[model samples]
Target: MIFYGKQNVNKVDIEAVVSVLQSDFLTQGPAIEKFEQYVAKYCGAKYAVAVTNATSALHIACLAAGLKKGDILWTTPITFTASANCGRYCGADIDFVDIDKKTYNISVEELEEKLINTDVKPKVVVPVHFTGQSCDMEKMYRLAKQYNFKIIEDASHAIGGEYKGHKVGCCEFSDMVVFSFHPVKIVTTGEGGMVLTNNKDLYDKLILYRSHGITRNQDLMTKKSDGPWYYQQIDLGFNYRMTDIQAALGYSQMQRIDEFVTKRRYLVNRYNDLLKDLPLILPYQIDEANSSWHLYVVKIDFNKVNKAKVDIFKEMKNKGVCLNLHYIPVHTQPYYQSLGFKQGDFPNSEAYYKEVFTLPLYYDLSYEEQDYIVQCLKEVLE
Candidate 1:
């Protein structure tokens, strides 16, 4: 069955990992630094810190941004829980900003309205780059400057994409940008993540927090070391370091990032051509942003289609097109509900959650497979 997403690994990726296995170190080694440097250089960021996964990357980035108890963190509710959970991990009160109905990224207009009316401004606003499309970050950046808030771009779905000619992780508009290297993402690190930043102090904090807050650097230590092995736990942190094996694979995968994004864009174009006449709302790309097309999500117009979203999903799956839902509204989750968020808090997110489903989208998906999936979708909708 065709899946919604899958990893594209070739002989080179395998060879990279195998060579790392033959080396002396498996966890912390030269590959890690090489991978970090490659990503930082590619994304045009001054520094990058590699971690175990995007969740850990978000955690460390939030901590580095000075998020703490009693501080409020805001993000779109239409993303994976990690985008919001990172703020919660720092003991910050998490809140949701609605998403744009078109791009499905965070809505800059709603964000402005929220910022203008609210008494207590958010300490950090995480604008998620949903489905590989960058948010209106320039506008968000303007708001951030006016309100004295930090911007943490949740760019988990956007690595090879660009916004207004700048690479998504360039940190041109945000204080920090987070990337995911999960199998389904643009590149695979076998479950790894990276945080990119332009600020030296935040970069240092991110590095410290990713590895149990321990610092071996003499410049950061309180006293001179008696031995070469001396270190200090500067603050509370977690074990979120990426393994060398993962880094080697990631470094190799980075070589094909452009190729992967190009293929996905080709598929998205084909899907748009084939599925335009169907009773569904196709994904939209903003004029200033180029999407990586990490997901090709379509919303079934329930009024036109005679089936519920679940029924259509089951039908497609049974027909060998294994589609998936991108997310449920984070605010409607039981955990968020307990936090005083309820069904009607964000109407747009709730509406989106009911109608949207991700189609087969990945680097290795072929034209024949895509045609089959489209045929199945047509049959399901019919």
Candidate 2:
């Protein structure tokens, strides 16, 4: 069966991992710094802190942004819970804005209205780059400047994407940006993530936060060391460090990010052409953005079809097409429902949940496989 998403690990990626296994240090070593440098340089950011996963990256970013009790953190409910859970991790009050019908990112117009009308100002606004397509960050940044709130870009789906001709993780429009390297993501480190920023202070804070807030650097320590072996827990932090083994794999994957993105875009274009006649609304890319195309989702017009999305999904799966939905609306989850969030809290997100499903998309998905998948989809629709 064709998978909706997958990792494309070649001999080079395996060799890199083997090399790290033979090295002296497996964790908190040179490979970690090398991977961080590689991502920072590629994304055009001044500094990057590597961590175990994107959730940790988001948590550290929220902490660095000074989110705390009584602070409001706003994000789109269309994303994974990690997007808003990170705010809760900091003891901050979480709120959500609806998504744009076309972009599937946070609605910039709604965001502006919310900011103007709400009595409590948000400490940070996380604009998720859903499906690897960037939100209108330039406009969001303009609003941020006017309202005095920080921007934390949830760029987990957009490592190789470009926004307004700049790399998505450059932190040009946001105060901080986070990336993921999960197996099914654009890049894979087995399991890893990174936080990018142009600010030195945030970079320093991220370093401290990733490793239990301990500092061996004499400059950061409160007092001088008695001997060579001396460290201090400067602040409360977590064990979120990425191992050298993971970093090595991530570094190797970084070498082919451009190629991976190119192939994914090719598949997206092919899907756009081949599926245009189908009763589905295909993804739209704005002129200013070049997506990494991590996912290719189409919203089915359930009104036109007699079958429900669940029935169509089962039919496609029975035909050997392993399709999956990108997400359920985060606010509609049982956990979020306990927080007073309900189904209709965000209408666009709820609407998206009913109709959208992801197709097979990865570096190694063949044309024949894609053709078969589309043929099965057409049959299922009929």
Candidate 2 residue lDDT tens string, 253-336: 999999999999999999999999888899988888999988898999877778888888899888888888978888988988
The clash count of every prediction, one per candidate, is 0, 0
203 Cα displacement, candidate 2 (Å) = 0.5
Residue 212, model 1: lDDT of: 91
Clashing pairs in 2: none
- In model 2, how many backbone clashes occur? 0
lDDT of 2 at 255: 98
RMSD of each: 0.7, 0.8
TM-score of each: 0.99, 0.99
| lDDT, model 1 | 0.93
* Cα lDDT of model 1 by residue, 198-249, tens digit: 9999999998999899999999999999898799998998999999999999
